[model samples]
Target: MTSVGTQEKTRPCPRCGAGIGGDERFTVWCAACDWNVDPEGPRKEPRRLDRTRRALARRHGEKLHAGIVSGEDLRARRDASALLALVIALAVHGVTAAVAALGIWCLVHGWGGWPMLPGLFLLLLAWVLRPRPASLPDHVPVLHRAAAPTLFALVDEVAEVAGTRGVDAIVIDGAVNASVQAYGMRGRRMLVLGMPYWEILTPQQRVALLGHELGHYGNGDVRHHTVLGSAYASLITWWYCFAPEDDPAATALELISNLLLLVPYWLVTGVLLLLDRLTLRASQRAEYLADRTSAHVGSTEAAVGLTDRMLVTDSVEAVLAREANRAALAGPSGYRAAGDRADELWERLTSHMASIPEAEYERQRRVGALRGHSVDATHPPTHLRRAGLIAGERMPAAVVVEGDRADRIAAELAGARRLVGRRIILDGPSFGG
Candidate 1:
């Protein structure tokens, strides 16, 4: 059998017609494509070291990253914390139940009666029925190895601004974005980039995006989200206990429980969902902080503004545009390529949007207006995000100027600065001023 160690290779600069002479000419710059692929694997991996040495070298790295988790890997910590909250509440419910039982015993004896016993039961029952955690995986991803240095550079800026350790892993996926995810107890962390990110964003924008993710990680954010999620969950208990069961705690308890059933659970659920969304405002606030950090590191306004651009996201609109409508130029897979024409497609889809039903379309328009407020959503609109910079609200991220990357970086900074509608000189000394 032939071994992969010996192979021939030739490739071009994916963006332009220039021939990349060898593996050394490229870096993992594109968060979108993961990394440049060669027909030959050497072509990529063998240049650094042999397979055995590479495997052995990662042992120390694995140890260093032992506690970090990110992205979907967050399920474990979320579930564990949720379970803990439930246990505490259940313990309290037990106490509440016992007190109610004592009241019932008194009422049965023809003594003055207590009425809250049934409400306690309702609270317990709600706790038992809250949604269970969804299953998650235990695998660590193999991100584009070439992108590590650039990702590290961004991580270093975050560390400087945030006063903490740098990122642990640089994961590449297909999401059109970059996110920071931490796992384990001691912040085993990752800088996860989606493949779509490169196709859709410029380098400065990518840097800004990384800064946003870093903001979430450095601010002790995961724990905050967990606590907030649990609090929102506790609302179920609140609604349940608003009135007890209808069986009869004297006659008044029965009447109240029946009346309580009329209490709008729908309204209660909406209120709980709203509270959860507001709690996530903390995460949103963290984004602004991270952007500030990125600007401090010398990321151009353009780079940071890239995130601002994406903030205008409307998934519902994007989906509708991609329907069987004639303007649907491509499907999801086509959009994954390095140069998929997303803007063209979005424009095409919107152009034909006049044909859809009015009532249904109106609802979507309302959704577009409320895009940022949904409980499970993240990332804000590009224009709204851009407005911050124009308003002089964010600092430019420190950008890397090397080789061909230099010219593009400068242009990106200028582009982002314009989008922000304002500019500030970003020097190394002043961090938070």
Candidate 2:
């Protein structure tokens, strides 16, 4: 296996198509490509790096698309896996339930002598193995149709374009991110639109973001995620349900029983880990396909611009939040003035970013290379997405609304913004007052 440095030397410059010299192999900047390589990786021409990244993204997208196109088969396989997991869970509980019933019968009858002991033990085991329903507490505020008509209308339009059912509800929060997912046994689709995230983008960019999220539904990615998630949850619950108590062993029998219990825990955990690893690549591919859908619905430029702005917006928000906290600490009045300070800082950051050239902005943005496969990651890395969007074919922009109409639509969410702000302050610790 050749080292990365040697491979860099052998590859041609992506920009000028010039051969990289031996000295340039170790340098950060490629004289020919005029691009800086990330310090984390071997030096390579920027354009070449972009090309490689794009190629890999495209391949992943293609495979995912192929799987999606065979929708019936994919669904069948997912259903089978889910059914198998469900059967296993039910079987485990069913056996415990049977044993408990037998124990109860023995206790009720005149057979309470030795039969009561096994019956009581079996009852305890059944109690421990009882299934626990998955519950996720609602942390963000959810908006209704009457409360956020404009936002709902915007979502409806995007859903129509993306060919998915409209979201059941919209959640507004203070984070700088947006997402769509299904929840509850009814599988109600919910759109989580961050107030800070919405404030940073133009009308077109917002549509692109909405389209990207809604695209997940159209491509069946949401269902895929749900199946995988449910299966993993069932396995984990089973593992925990039978987990041995933390009490120290008082005798050889107790020690043996504790050791025996660990066997099922490790086996279930190993299966869960393996499943996660196998599904991670597919999850990343779903993200890329969603990006493609966004590009198709709202132009490649809009999709790409949203990704770029996201990187800057996160940094700007962090800096402003810290500054606001510091000011609030100084005086009582500062607590009331924190919002104004944040607005001022945000404007400055946006203006500075706008004034910079695209190349300079790209170089300055601290995005890393495409991430390798990981069991825990649900989305592809930002840098890989940036490159892929850049290489994607341009499409005519899908205009949902523009000019004063867009402004009016955004204005309708003022109440939501206030709610989010109040929630943030209320939930947060007091600085001075």
Candidate 3:
């Protein structure tokens, strides 16, 4: 493969007659006109349910974006839909309580012979299906304020600007993404920073990322609330527990078990679908609100830059994968240890990102508009987000990370950067594209 800076062959794009440069062995396109930019058409979603959900999300996202463009308020409001979602969530929990009560009744009243066996089984099932509170994963590395004072101080400042509490912990991981999740029974917040994503962002864009994530805490998104979140989790578990096996039943007893579970399984599936539908608009709205908060805190330009960066995250993953593959193919003799390559890894990433043409970003935006491409099923289309930021009121950054402080934050992250860089060299990014 050819690196960006090297002299390579060039040809005019057939569609726009603009010069395209690259190694002949590799694909090249006119960045000026986006010719052949999305050579592969939109990916086929094989699952009928997934396709349906995507369609719904796209439709609702368009509506929400339209609303924003029309100068509708972005503040969270508990309208009928939100209230209904809460009611349904409570009803789901009620069902769980009923199951638990039944198990307790069985244990107390049916403590004899075969009845005792079924009673224990019911109790066990209830325990397994219980609503789970948020908790932090034990394995990932965590950063605290005392250890990374400069970075945490920046985060605290961003949190203050967003009108939310600062995170309880900061988790650094290798994925090409960032998120804020509520954990523990008390709902302490954790900000998960994906170093791959972080390394590519500009300083202001980094602040915007923080503003957007922290904004979730104040957004009142039903999907993130404990009652709804835990209930959704419980319903998922219930669905899996009762779902029929892929293989045909092996015996008469197995067949009976499947038959007995089919109705409840479908019931759980229906509830899951209903809950998702009910919360869909609210979740998307919350995301938009967060984006607005990002803009308010880091300035609209920075937030828009962050969104544009998101549009090309696929390229980021591809480049990282290539680096990892190169390392693997070279073996120990061909290259230094992964730790030694850390600085080089980031430098290459920064260069690659900087080398991307503005036309290429525009191409991505166009492709996103065509495909309704979003960060996931959860987020609005990236193009729409960029447009929304452009349309909304613009403001100067509420919190700025000046050059000296930016350097200090980078210095603090140096150790973490090395660890993540080594991991990526060994196993590639954990985002799985």
Which candidate number has the best TM-score?
3
Which candidate wins on lDDT? 3
TM-score of candidate 1 to 2 decimals: 0.41
Evaluated at residue 224, the lDDT of candidate 1 is 37
Candidate order by TM-score, highest to lowest? 3, 2, 1
Instruction: Give one digit per residue, the lDDT tens place, for model 1 in 1-433.
Output: 1123423245655766444332221222222232333222221233211232233223322321231211111111233444454454455445445655555554566434344555445445544544233122233233332434544655566566655666666654333345555444454666655433333455555555655566565654532343343444455665565533545345876776566665655454555444434333343444444545555554647544454334323432243333323222444444343133434433333343322233332333233233322112333333233334444434544554456654543343332222111111111011110
Per-residue lDDT of candidate 2, residues 1-433 (tens digit): 2223443244566666765433332333444555444445433434432344444444554455455445422221233444454455455556557867877886776364887777777677666654433333376677777877777877787788777778878877776677776677767778888766776776788888888888887766632455445555556566676466666645778677778888877776666554544454445566766777787777888888877775565344654465556665767676666555545544544554444344334543443433232111345556556666766567767745677777677577665665555444434421110
Where in model 2 is the C-alpha error above 4 Å? Answer: 1-139, 222-227, 233-265, 336-360, 364-367, 370-376, 422-433
- 1 or 3, which is superior by TM-score? 3
After superposition, the stretches of candidate 1 with alpha carbons farther than 4 Å from their true spots are 1-150, 185-187, 219-226, 229-274, 277-284, 298-300, 311-382, 393-396, 404-433
Per residue, candidate 3 scores C-alpha lDDT tens digits across 319-361 of 8888888888989842567778877888998888887766567
Candidate 3: regions farther than 4 A off: 1-35, 242-262, 330-336
Give the candidate order by descending lDDT.
3, 2, 1
Error of 2 at 82 (Å): 8.3
**Regarding lDDT, does 1 or 3 come out ahead?**
3
List of clashing residue pairs for candidate 2: none
Query: Per the 3 Å backbone cut-off, how many clashing residue pairs does candidate 3 have?
Result: 0
Candidate 2 lDDT (Cα, 0 to 1): 0.59
